[model samples]
Target: MAEKVTAYRFDRIDETLSQLNREDCAIIAGGTDVMVLHKSRRGVPPKFSKPIVFIDHLSELKQVYQTDKDLHIGACCTYTELLEHPLIPTPIKSAIKTIAAPAIRNRGTVGGNICNASPAGDMLPLLYVYNAKVLLRSVNGDRFVAISDFIQGPRRIQRLHNEIVTEIILPSVLEEGTHVIFEKVGNRNADAIAKVSFAGFMRINKERIEDIRFAFGAVGPTMIRSREIEKKLVGKTLPLADAEIDTIVAEFDKIIRPIDDQRSTAVYRKTVALNLLRYFLSLKQ
Candidate 1:
């Protein structure tokens, strides 16, 4: 008879990460992606070997804080937690709460969503639009990486195996007329991954746009912040003629590149993204 592999849980991040660094153990969070990968024998080790270190109990990673200057969300804050956090701005809370179902949202950590490095990850586009930062730590020390630069490609990242993501930092977005919006185009809007998703930030000054930030996900190799499109919208006021809106729409089309995948066709994704852009721009409520 073969020996059965047992799972382990870590109560402290520093202690567990240090041990895992020495032993090269497998890390598990929600076990959403890990279990599937193991079952399929795709990339992860089988259940019979490598010790599994679960970090779900790290209380330090489950907090959300807001100061006059910034918002700090601990790495293990689950989607359900974020949805309920009083400091998470309304639009962001609304967007993330709708991801998958209640059960998955309850278990999926925001850090896992990021460290997993999936382009289609629901929380990523929102992170990009908010100018979030990822805090990483290892036995060596701590470092911060911009969310925009953290994810390198589909299922790839710059995160070293020895490093653990400790926190996510978001600057305060509390302001009058600070319009933030998120859009996702999916087949059924039920357990559907984003065929294409976008998030935008706008601050209105008088009758004009003061600042703008735009981002898109599930359409490229990684979630992207489109500074070029954002630049075009900044200082541009609404109630403009049809021609100006048309020009802006054309510019948006140039920034996003959608590809065909199991969930949707390339053409459909592109068209839907453009339509959503128009819809978001036209909204006042």
Candidate 2:
């Protein structure tokens, strides 16, 4: 017979961290993904045999606030909550709005999305463009890590077993005149996983690119961001000549090596990723 699962819920962060330190357990906050995996195991052996510790009710992990420099979003804040919140940046709002459907959005937490670490996750590319940082906590203490460093690969992260992500920190506001864009290609408009996605932020002053960043999703083991490529574009003038665009496109071709997956072909994803960048450039032209 399979071992029965047990659940523990706590209202205090300290108590939760103490329990995690004492025993092995699986952390669940917004059972959106966890419950699906559990229910799908019909006859198959369960992947998780440990007890579950529920943190969805922890008030400490559900806040959305701002400081002088950054906005802090608690890990348990759901996609629905982000949509309703006034402080969410335009690019992030645009990206999160494309996630699943209304019901899943209501139940899915930002931390759950980050911890799940799906390469196709809609929020990741936005987080990358914003240079967000994740705050993690444990019985020992707390630490902050950049979004890129926090998520090492698909379904893998640097978070320790006893640590829980408490919040994400992002710039309180983008600079004036900055333009942000998010583009996604999927099988369906709603409730569909991304075949390829792109998120970009750029600021132009006097017809010259003052700052810029780009992130691509569902095209690799992890979301792709290239500071080297971004550097080449920053300080360059807008309306890039065809030759310059071709050079940049060729550089991107070398960076992304997608593999054929159930949702899309590698060729299609690669082509779309490049085209998305081209489209963003066109917007400025």
Candidate 3:
């Protein structure tokens, strides 16, 4: 005999939170990754083992609004919705456009993507570069955590079982003349999981590199970014000398640790990550 499953649907945030606080339940929004896990029987803490609380229909978690300093994205907002919204940053838009296909994008929520915490999750690298924050709400209160801190490991996060991610906050203004790039290599073009992915933002002023941020995914336990490496090139002049480029590439090679898996080899992922970074930097000239 199989275990019986119980499901609860709530249209209000408070009601959902109350249920979450009182019972041991899994909170589900888009059900994209969760469903796959439930069907495949893979991953830690097997899916559908406990009661489920569905919050996807709550209007409170489906909004996209902005303030003077930040843009607030609701937890249940879908990728297609974000892509269609004018307030979404261009870099973010570029990245979201590459997720799955139209049908999957229509049902896949940004919050779900973040909470799923896949190493190759397309949204995370951009969020990491943007210095995004996640807002978690529980019956007890609310808490905010940096994107970097929120994701503890592959398929692991800081969110308590009783808390729900309510919003994702990002800076409203990015540096002027910043160039952003998002690149991914997968088994196929559409709907395929990434073998390796990279997102970069750089700004050059007067032929001198003013600011730079780089993130690589599916090459580490979590999305990879190094402030130490970024600091080294911040004030350097562009049209970088071959020696300088080699030095930066060497540093990146040291940091990116990949593993051979079903999708790709460790060697292939590391090679592509470095190549993409080199190509992105070359575009600044």
Candidate lDDT values, in order: 0.79, 0.88, 0.88
Cα displacement (Å) at residue 285, model 3: 5.6
The true-versus-predicted C-alpha distance at residue 90 of model 2, in Å, is 2.2
Find the 10 residues in a row with the least total lDDT in model 1.
40-49
Model 3 lDDT tens row, 92-129: 88888787989989999999999999999988888888
TM-score of each model, paired residue for residue: 0.90, 0.94, 0.94
**Residue 96 local lDDT, model 3:** 81
For model 1, the stretches where C-alpha displacement exceeds 4 angstroms are 1-7, 41-50
lDDT per residue, candidate 2, 187-244, as tens digits?
A: 9988898999999888888789988889999999999999999899888897877887
Error of 1 at 233 (Å): 1.9
Better of 1 and 2 by lDDT: 2
Cα lDDT of model 1 by residue, 135-219, tens digit: 9888989899999888889878778778878899987666577888888777766567888888878788776987777777887
- TM-score between model 3 and native: 0.94
Cα TM-score of candidate 1: 0.90
Ranking by lDDT: 3, 2, 1
lDDT of 1: 0.79
Note the clash tally of each candidate: 0, 0, 0
Candidate 2, overall lDDT? 0.88
